[model samples]
Target chain A: MSFDLGLVIEYFPRLLSGAGLTVELIAISSLVGICIAVPVGLMRVSASPTLRNLSLAYVFFFRGTPLLIQIFLVYYGLSQFEAVRNSVLWPFLRQPYWCAIVAFALNTGAYTAEILRGAMQAVPRGEIEAARAFGMSTALLFRRVILPRAVRIGWPAYGNEVIFMIKGSALASTITLLDLTGMARTIIAKTYAPVEIFLAAGLIYLAIVFVLTRAFRRIEARLNRYLLHESA
Target chain B: MFDLKGFGDQLLLGALMTVGLALSVLCVGTILGLAGAIAKLSKSAPARFAAETYTAVLRGIPELLIVLVIYFGSSGLLTAAAEAMGHDGFVELSPFAAGVTALSLVFGAYATEVFRGAILAIPKGQIEAARAIGMNRRLVFLRVTLPQLWRVALPGLGNLFLVSQKDTALVSVIGLEELTRKAAFATGFTKAPFTFYMAAAVLYLTITSVTMVGLHLAERRASRGMPGMRG
Candidate 1:
């Protein structure tokens, strides 16, 4: 009936370590995700049928299924393979941390690729043609012309993806990784105060998302400054 | 490595449970979504705040966390309530309820956006047109606004449903005997996790792939006679 501030404070230190783990997982997967997304996004819009189709199927499969299912498939499914055990890859595969990262990265890559593909299309075609007219090489044309526009267009959505990856790290708990959500669950089982712990964790997540949304909004404002100045 | 007999039954059960859960969740979620979307667009500021906050919280949290929160969190709250009322018994949330609630929360959030977007997409002129014909506000919304909104929202709702259907696997965390849980149970019994998980994956892919075509058909049918909508 009465709110228990002292209980919440007592558990705050315990949950802090788990929050740290959650941040690290999200940060690692996010950096790796950009790496995977840029190339895959490029491939999705590539001139080569082979690359495009393969990339298309990869995006389709990953984005279509639940991330939890995908995580289990990678963690448990690969462990079942003899060749995987016999191969040198088991060293990486055997660890839950790496498996979680790999799954999170692949999952984020699929979603990010779609975001980037849409952003890539948003870049003005005439500008790319203009770059070509100036005898800009393909690499220079992409680096100078395509990526900046795509990056600008995709930043808001990419910012949402950052919030998403932070939340998705909660699933690593299922694989026995003690992220924030997982720690909260353990704390709840011990204290039987699920609402306090879970609610606290949710607030932590909300705080992270709020910060991210603000950062993205600032970037969007900065990007639109010239339009704002002209209008004024 | 494959346990043919068990695999047959588990896959069959998993598919049926998954689809049944999805259909149930879809119906509940859509109802919640429709009301939420309407509330969101209503003149009341409190309504707007409630709607916005619900969607933001639901969308921001992982489906898995939502599942855990309600699965454990809600029950904790309920039990505390009961004890306070001097009821000396525990209240357990059936895994099905947890699954449905978790998914519906996610679905409703996405659907709120879809429905709100759809409602906004309806031209102001059409409402004016209906008003010119002496239509009431209810008549304007129902006769002029609602029909077009469906066509605009159907593709998005379809996508949300597809996402929710896969997300039903999240109930497995609470030991629900849906597709993933059933597979995990089978693996425990058989000790050969590969075959069962592969079978579950194939079943998921089949459902998702088939639903995509159905969604495409629904979108095409809904968008007929709309202008500049060749996609």
Candidate 2:
């Protein structure tokens, strides 16, 4: 049987909207994820035993299990609890969109935290000693020296997390969130042409990933250039 | 309000199924990865391009989408082909076959990079020495290259295997009765989502931890005679 290229063109518009939702899911989740990750990452590197262990446990659990299971736990398990259902948070938890966001955010946050923590630990010890010799306060030292260096070190791996999140956002479809993959699945159901619709969806994902990969590479190069001795 | 009761055996069986699926996918993926790494390293332009395209496309797409597409897409293609051949019956992929194929493709794409890196890590001098000793190409590869390749690739391959194992859960969406699907089934019957999901998570963590320990031991063993290797 021949493939009709026309189907791809005709469905392109719908796929674009689907891609928009995917981008929204990824953008919102990643922003929220980074917000959560910074504190957790910092805590993971903190001197306090309690904070470090707590963050370690959080990362361990999230990274250990599959994202699909986490989504279901949030979407289904939380709703199962009578107290959770009656709580003020229930309104947000009731929606599949919110559940997806929460799950995605937490999952990405765990990964981003680990990346950031690794980067933070990789910062030159002598540089930190130099900063301390200057009598910089903890806050000033962190803001002026550690944070920027950590980000530069972590950016490439963090970029991988972002790419992974884009792919992970496809799981929103499983929870009935009508994201990119969801829309593709819907179209396939209506047209019974899985080959065409899914190919279109996969291609859309490929395009987005290709662009992101290129952007990250450029950013990494710029970051590397800043670190060169001659440039200094 | 949590009780697993009779579902214990089912969950255990599901874990076995998950392991079986992952292992099968690993074997298929390792074969694909070897082929892909060779293609990527080949002198021919077309071979390198094909390998690059394979990794780029497969790695870029979500594994969930791949599973869905392969499950439904192949069935449609197969049915159409059957019809063209004057057959009248339905042609569908069992979820196991589709899951294995999709996961293998996913694992293979990622493993290609790891294998390629491992191959590159082998010293060129060693291969040259083998050639100078008058060993045939196949013998040189088997005796010199293969032994060293596995040592370098083990850690990365192990990590990919962990990812692949968790990905088996995604196949549940297409109706494979792996751990996640088994948990979903239990939740539907017992209406105890928290219990089932929590149990599934624990089960997965157990598998992950055990595998990590095994990999660490294997890595230590592999690095035993190497200089400056640390635990």
Candidate 3:
């Protein structure tokens, strides 16, 4: 059959709303994930063996398993426990939306922690020494010298984590969140036109990811303007 | 509160299927990656653009959507094309085939970058030296390029395969009876979601750790007798 433009136009609003929920899901989870990552990452690089090993275990467990299983475990598995159901946290855990956020945040947190840890280690030792030589306190040294440099060095990879989180947010659909893919699946069920509906869905994702990557590239360039002169 | 009795066989079967699917995808992905790298490196502008777009589009989209589209969409397209070719039958795309195709496409897109880097890492003078020794193009590639490319690409490809292994779980969404699906199935009957999923997670972790050890051994083997190489 030939292509039908009419279906796409008719379904655009529904698809747009789905995309909105997707954006909402991604934005909130990624923000929480980054917040989680920063502390975990710091803990990873800390001198204390207890802290470092605990952070390493956290990263290992999350990174080892598939995200799909993680989502199922949180969404379906957690509710299986009577203690959890009777607890004050049950209200939040009962919702698929919250379960998704929990899973995405935890999973991305593990990855971002590793990225930040690598970036922290990669920061030039000389710069760190200079700050110490000036008698900057540990807090001041990290605030003024370490974090800024680590973030600049790790931003590109962190940008990748953002894109991954977006792509990953699609998994929320599987848990009944009615995100972009969920909307597309619903539309296809009604119209019996999987190709057209899914293509539209895919293109919308492409556009968002395209915009995100471009924005990241600009930020990376702006961050490294000082190094640009030497390279050119 | 947990029992795996009588479910062990099913889980084993599912894990085997997971490995089988991963291997199929790896073969397809490596071929596509090699071809994609060549196209991107080629002089033809159209080839370069096509390769670039392939990687960008595949990498940009969600792997689940790709699997859904290929599994559900291909049947209609294939049937239409079959009719156009004077055939008169409904064509069905197996979930296995669709899963393999989709997973491989995702695998290949990332692999393209790995292969491209590996290829570029081979120095120009080495190829020139091989040519100067009167070696043909095929001999040069087999004797020089292929060996170095394997060493350089192994770590990246090993990581990709592990990621792809987890991705194989996504195929369960499209009705493949892989590890994740089987776990879900058992969870349904036993009403023990945590037990089954945790078991599946441990199984996956086992596969990952085993493959990692294998990869470590392979890296050591490849690096043997080479200066500056580490264990």
Candidate 4:
């Protein structure tokens, strides 16, 4: 009933240990998600209707459902098929870590794609026209003009996505990964101090979010330095 | 090749439960969000600070942790309260209550920002015009603000509704037997995790897709007569 500061203090270090895996999950999934998102996001805004529709369906399915279901589908659903079990992919698929990463990457990729599509579409038409006038090819124009501009525009939203990924990575605990949330649950099970442990865990999450937010603000400022000087 | 083995009805019920939970959270969260937005925009410094802390803490933490904390933490608090009241046995909070409370808090935190932005988007002159017409503060809000707020907040709120619906799946972790929980149960019973989860996924997709269409219609209706605003 009484709050135990000592218990929280003692478990804080253990919770920090789990923070490593949490960060790892977010970092790896987000990197892979960006890779997946860039192509899919480009496809969303592609000139080809087929590419656009295919990417639209991909985004819809992933965004429309819960990430938990996606993770379960990959982790539990896939194993239901004998083919998957016997396949060479089984070794990677059998581990919950890979399953969580795959699901997180796909889910975030869908969201990031939408964000990227909006940013890409919002790129100044004049910039593209100018790029073409300068005799730049499609690839070069995308590389030099559209991609940089879209990234600058999309950075804030993508930062929020990264925060979402951090919060979402907690779901990895459900599939038995000893991420921060899992470690908190394990500590609670042993100590029977759910309130203290969870409170401690929540504080760590808040700290991570706080730090990331500050970092994102710095990056955003740096990215928009040109606009800052123009306004000044 | 996929058989539900008469568990189809259970899955349907679970889907209904999920909707019920999300709807309840939507109602409660909207009220909380309105109050939070007002508090954050209030003149009093403490009210603004309290609102800021509420949103910051709730939004920063993972929803699962909030659920777990409420599930286990509330029981402890309830038992302690009952003890102080001279009750003999331990008290427990139902998983449904805990789920609703946690999810509503999470939803309210996000909705606070949405509502705040929507409120800010209302032209300052409109409120002044209402006041000039001798309308009281309450009347200004009810007659002048609420309608416009709904129009502006609908899209954000609709997105939140979809999110809250999906978040209901997280409640199954605390044993609420929502759609996701039902799929897990069916999987356990039939050893067909793929089929049941796929069914659950399809059911969820249906719910979200239907909700999307409804939101689109609502947005169109809300933006009626506002030229160039209709999507």
Best by DockQ: 4
lDDT of each: 0.85, 0.91, 0.91, 0.93
lDDT of 1 by residue, B39-143 (tens): 899999999999999999888877777887788767767889999999978887888998898889889988998999989998888888889989998888888
Q: What docking grade applies to model 4?
A: medium
Docking class of 1: medium
Q: Compared with the true structure, what per-residue lDDT tens digits does model 4 show for residues B56-155?
A: 9998999989998999889878898899999979888798999999999999999999999999999999999999999998899899988899999999
Off by over 4 Å in 3: A229-232, B79-91, B134-139
**Residue range A39-117, candidate 3, lDDT tens digits:** 9999999999999999998888888889999999999989999999999999999999899999999999999999999
Best by TM-score: 4
Please list the residue runs of candidate 2 whose C-alpha ends up more than 4 Å from where it truly belongs after superposition.
A228-232, B76-92
The predicted structure with the larger DockQ, 3 or 4, is: 4
TM-score of each: 0.92, 0.93, 0.94, 0.96
In candidate 2, list every pair of residues with a backbone clash. Answer: none
**Inter-residue clash pairs, candidate 1:** none
Expressed as tens digits, the lDDT of each residue in B71-134 for candidate 2 is 9788878899899999988897899999999999999998999999998999999999999999
Looking at model 1 chain B, report the run of 10 residues with the lowest lDDT sum.
Answer: B1-10
Per-residue lDDT, model 3, residue A121, is 93
Shift in Å, residue B71, candidate 2? 1.4
The segments of candidate 4 whose C-alpha lies over 4 angstroms from its true place after superposition are: B78-92
Deviation in Å, model 1, residue A93 alpha carbon = 2.3
| lDDT-best of 1 and 3 | 3
Model 3 chain B — which ten-residue stretch has the worst lDDT? B1-10
Clash tally, candidates in order? 0, 0, 0, 0
